[model samples]
Target chain A: MKIVVCAKYVPDATGDRKFNADNTVDRVGVDGVLSELDEYAVEEALQIRDATDGEVVVVTVGPEVARAAVLKSLQMGADSGVHVLDEAIHGSDSAATSLILARAVERQRPDLVLCGMASTDGGMSVVPAMLAERLGLPQVTFASEVVVEDTTVRIRRDGDAATEVIEATTPLILSVTDQCNEPRYPSFKGIMAAKKKPVETLTLGDLGIAADQVGLDAAWTRVDGFTERLPKSAGTVVTDDNGSGADQLVSFLVSQKFV
Target chain B: MSEILVLVDHADGSVRKTTAELLTFARRLGTPSAVFIGAGIESARDALRQYGAERVYVVDSPDVGDYLVAPKAEALAQLVQRTGPAAVLLPSNAEGKEIAGRLAIKTASGLITDAVDVTPADGGVAATQSVFAGSYTVNSAVTHGTPIVTIKPNSTTPEAVEGSAVEERVDVTISELAKTARVVERKPREATGRPELTEAAIVVSGGRGTGGNFEPVEQFADTLGAAVGASRAAVDSGWYPHAYQIGQTGKTVSPQLYVATGISGAIQHRAGMQTSKTIVAINKDEEAPIFELVDFGVVGDLHTVLPAATAQVQARKG
Candidate 1:
């Protein structure tokens, strides 16, 4: 059995996430790293493969720097990596991303496909569902816990109103949340092993995709404009020096009609 | 009139407040047409009518009610083809986002999720998104087919307005592929008699300062009839269940009032509630980083501040 892990390199959430001249995220100026959330998906994939004695292949599609995403997964115990880098892939929306990812995942036929619940940058949390629709497979997303037995896969989804247990078979897409498992750090030996592992690079042409079908020019959504939110005013601050802190807060709430 | 399709979000034949919020917001673009895809239209009709629903399309299909979101997406795809609405509006929950995602592909439309506001633009509906932990405000629009947008709850006040709410029953042929994944079991959270966090007007949250005790936080929330929430730190430390965790991965709440007790206000936690109309914090540390952004602050221990404040509020009410 083979499992494919879909990973992404996102702008660091701690940095000042800014927009470029073209309204795209400023990935160049800000430090980029493998999305912290995707680490759980990579870990879950590795565990499933270790249990089943299969190969774990990591796939990513983005700018050239996105190869780091694949490399990070490789260092964490993946067998190989595939980076889909192309100049035409910039500013792709979730729809375009699902298209590219669906093609890249199709290039590597696997029993299971896994992805993080959402990227910290885009944070749309819609790509996995769209990819499932594009790939014509069942998708069990937002899995807090996953257990696999033979060909059956079950996941516990913690939603807003309820916690549901969903079941599906192989040949499907699964997205794991941060609660799934703890992501392991790459040991020195694992890093050395990852250096020798095969890392293949592909372009839009290699995946049978047209340049006109991607990038900002072909995106379905357009950014009209943006503005920096004005800094909020610091209305009041009261210390507990006189034991009147709670009373002050209640008075403020009363003035605001919250009491 | 250009029609805007609003998908009803319901549970066990009861409509959720998010649906009312969605319908109220959808009216800004065009005439609001609700798409009810389960067995609860009868119970939801009055609320829908009260919220200015000009037309209500119903599909009480078992295949859709029993399965995950894919079947509903398929059913919506057929509806979009038949009605050709100006835009599709759905609640920005997990299920609603997934449905809009698949429906975007099936209808060849642009998908925007977690939009805080939507309005009519020149070519299409413009969505206002709060990005980068509420640092930037972005205005976006769909450039492709029908615009599909998922709106976050508490985006706007749900105002009651009379409407025809003329009902229409439609049949959608759901494909077998959509029903592949099955919901084997459901364990709904036990009733707390509190408002849902995301849709609440007021929310009081606690963090590491609680030291595994949420009684004070719950008591304060109960006094004000507000919802209860916990920071990711509290949940990860086993102080609270994951269901009530509020952070970047957990629920993002934009309520009218947000009070953080004992939380140091990490960037992740700030992202979840930064857009709140009024922010207040109570912490022992004066420089807890949460103070810089809050509208009001009290420098003291949460255990002492919250209970005292709760009592004062109760006294004021009496």
Candidate 2:
């Protein structure tokens, strides 16, 4: 079995996101981390590889900076890595990103493709479905559990209100939700072995894709500008002078139409 | 001129409120048509008619509803090919978003999701998105294939218009690759008396300041017929279900009216609801960041304030 997990490197979600004078994110001094959600997808792929004794490959489409994302996946136990880097791939929206990923997946022809339900930075859970459309493949989003038996894979999904069991064949796309599983930390042995893994770096020209197919030019959406929120004026402070919490609260409530 | 298509979101053919909302937005760009994929058109027709759908394309195919979003998207893509629609509109829920994303790539069209507003541009549709946790409002236009837009609910009040509801049988042949995955079984959610969070017009949310007691917040939500939401802190504490969390890590809700009680308005929390039309916050701490974005604010203990407000709203309803 050949399993592929898509990875993206982004600013650490926990870090403070600062803005530059031009309104773009200030990445000069911020620490970068593996896209938190993608880690779960990589873990799921690694577990599947472990079960099936197959090769696990990680792919990412971004700048040289994105190399870290693919390397991180390798450190987590992936057997191979592919980085599709080019200036043309920059500024692509979710749609364009899916197009590029679909093309790359088509070339690799993996039996299974796994992705995080949504990227933490974009928060737009559109890639899996978009890739499914581009590849003409069936996909299930927000998968909580996956079980492969014979030719078919069974999945249990924890939806908003209920749990459902789903069955799909290999070569299917599964976008794992955050609740799927707790990702494992990279062990010392695994980290050591990752350095020996094959990491192939490819450019857009090598893929035979047009420059106009992605980036801001092909993007369906454009962000005009970002305006910082206005600071809040001081709120009215109702002093609890009497020290009776209930009475003071009632007085304030009545004043605000809570009564 | 090809008609614009809308995927009618319904249960038992009864068109959902968001379907009307999408149709209202659809009319701004082109001729509006409704694509009803599953069964129950008989029950859904009245609502679809009232929502200005000139044509209701019905796909009575069995496999269409048996699986997940794949078949529905294939059907929509098929319809798009034949009818040559200029654009497609879908509600921005999980299912709709997935289907829309697939359909856009299948048609090689420009797709935009989570749009808060839409209006006609020179020759196409202009859509707006509140991104980066509502810190930025983006105005965009699709420059590629038929523009596909998935709009958030409650972005605009749905307006009904009289239209001849014409039904057409849409032919959809499933692709071999489309069957890569199939849903083996489905179990409906146990009915909760409360409304769905995404569909609710009003949402009342609690946060860390709730002190692990959600009674007051829940009571206020129930009184106002609003969905109950929680902050990650509240959900992490098991004060509420993870599904009710509204934050970067949780659900994104843009209700007409959002009431935040005892929430400090963390950036993560604000990312989920800052676009809401009207915000109201109640917290004893004047320093709570939630007050920064709210149109109305009250500084007080929710334990004493909520019961009285619930009574007042209940009395008004009476």
By TM-score, who's the top model here? 1
lDDT of 1 by residue, A1-259 (tens): 6899999998888877889989998776778889989999999999999999998999998887888888899999999999998989999889998999999999788889999988988788999999999999999999999999988899999988789998888899999998999999999998999999998999999999999999999999999789999988876878975559988999899989998
TM-score of chain A of each: 0.97, 0.88
Q: What clash pairs does model 1 have?
A: none
Q: What does the TM-score come to for chain B in model 2?
A: 0.93
lDDT of 2 at B229: 96
TM-score of each: 0.98, 0.88
The alpha-carbon RMSD over the true interface for every model, in angstroms, is 0.9, 3.8
Question: Could you tell me the lDDT of residue B49 within candidate 1?
Answer: 92
lDDT of each: 0.91, 0.79
Q: Give the 10-residue window scoring lowest on summed lDDT in candidate 2 chain A.
A: A237-246
lDDT of 2 by residue, B1-318 (tens): 458899998765767778989989887777789999888989998888888889999998778766878888889998998888878999887788888888877787888888989888766778888776787666777877888899987788888897687988877898767665677787766665777887787899999889999998988888767899999889878798777889876788888778888898988798899877667787889888787787677777777666666766666567
